[model samples]
Target: MTAQVKYDDVEVGTEIPAQTYQIDRMNLVMYAGASGDFNPIHWRENFARKVGLPDVIAHGMYTMAQGGRFVTDWVGDPGAVLDYGVRFSAPVVVPDEGGAALEISGKVEQKLDDNRVVVALTARSSEQKVLTRAKAVVRLA
Candidate 1:
């Protein structure tokens, strides 16, 4: 699917709108079941603290997906993204009562040939940077 966002219409250093996602323990449980990565650090608070974490944490890949969603939603086509990656810098600590919030924002870092642009992403949870070196290469209409 071609992106509704046109490459010619975009500019380097353009800011994509930001988004915030509410992440709860149930979301982690569902992610674990879907990914088969039921590591206790994600769902078991006691085990997470035992492992030196503040509390139950969200999966790294799950957090990455949220960043991807932020980019794709902006361009208006998931298939428009040719490449995406992130380095996990911190954990999204999910508390028992209110859970956690993942805030994501992006900017167009570079405009490339072939209708592609490099999108730089930032992901934060609990006022902490959760993902670093996050970027996406997207082909636009």
Candidate 2:
């Protein structure tokens, strides 16, 4: 685990290290089982095509969870998060053989009272953003 981030030491515009996460059919299946979100669009390509999607895509919540991971990983504690949200801008298309790659990075956008900071996030897949306006407020040590 990383050392805890201290509020006094962090400032607006500080950048968090980027992370790349891989998602595949098995990941979607596991998420479906755990989240009860077994939507076909997340796993079945033909069904996704029928529904007007380019291919099987990842769940919005799963993508959001990745955002959460980015925050928690930085803060070094899940309990540090006070607020987190995002806007799903596009789908993370999952191909059968190679899986999809979610490239995520964050920057400090705001510093608030009570030892908190807002971290702005960007998540991309397939050369396009999958989530936008994503931010997390974290209370640091």
Candidate 3:
């Protein structure tokens, strides 16, 4: 694990190292079992298309969790996250052949009083659509 990022060391526009995640049908099925979100759109291609989706998509929360992991991993502790939220801008379409890949990146957006910083995040799938627009308030040591 990386050492904690001190509040004094961060500044607006500081970029966190980006991470890439791959999601396949099996992973989505596992997530469904683990999260108890059996929404057909996440696993059944026909159901997804019937619901207006191009293909079976990964769960929004699963994508959000990956984004959260990016921040927590960078900060070295999950407790450093004071607050986090995301707007699901688009679905992550997982192809049956090669699956889907998501690239997530974060930037320090602002510095706040009392050892806090705001991190802005952007997640994009292979299709180039913004999958998640997320922001988090992190308490630095």
TM-score of each: 0.96, 0.97, 0.93
- Please write out the lDDT profile of model 1 over residues 1-141, one tens digit for every residue: 334898888899899888999999999999999999999999998999998998999999999999988888889998899999999999999998999999999999999999999999999987899999999999988
Residue 69: error of model 3 in Å? 0.4
Superposed Cα deviation of residue 10, candidate 2 (Å): 1.1
> Model 3 — TM-score against the truth?
0.93
Give the whole-model CA lDDT for all candidates, comma-separated. Answer: 0.92, 0.94, 0.90
| Candidate 2 local lDDT, residue 51 | 91
Model 2: lDDT equals 0.94
Question: Clashing residue pairs, candidate 1?
Answer: none
State in Å the error of residue 122, model 3. Answer: 0.7
- What is the per-residue lDDT of model 3 for residues 1-141, given as tens digits with 9 covering 90 to 100? 789888888889999988898889999999999999999999899999998999999998999999889999999889999999998888899978899999998999999998999999989997565655589999999
User: Could you give the C-alpha RMSD of every candidate to the true structure, in order shown?
Assistant: 1.6, 0.8, 1.3
Q: Which stretches of candidate 3 lie over 4 Å from their true place?
A: 131-133
Q: Of models 1 and 3, which has the larger lDDT?
A: 1
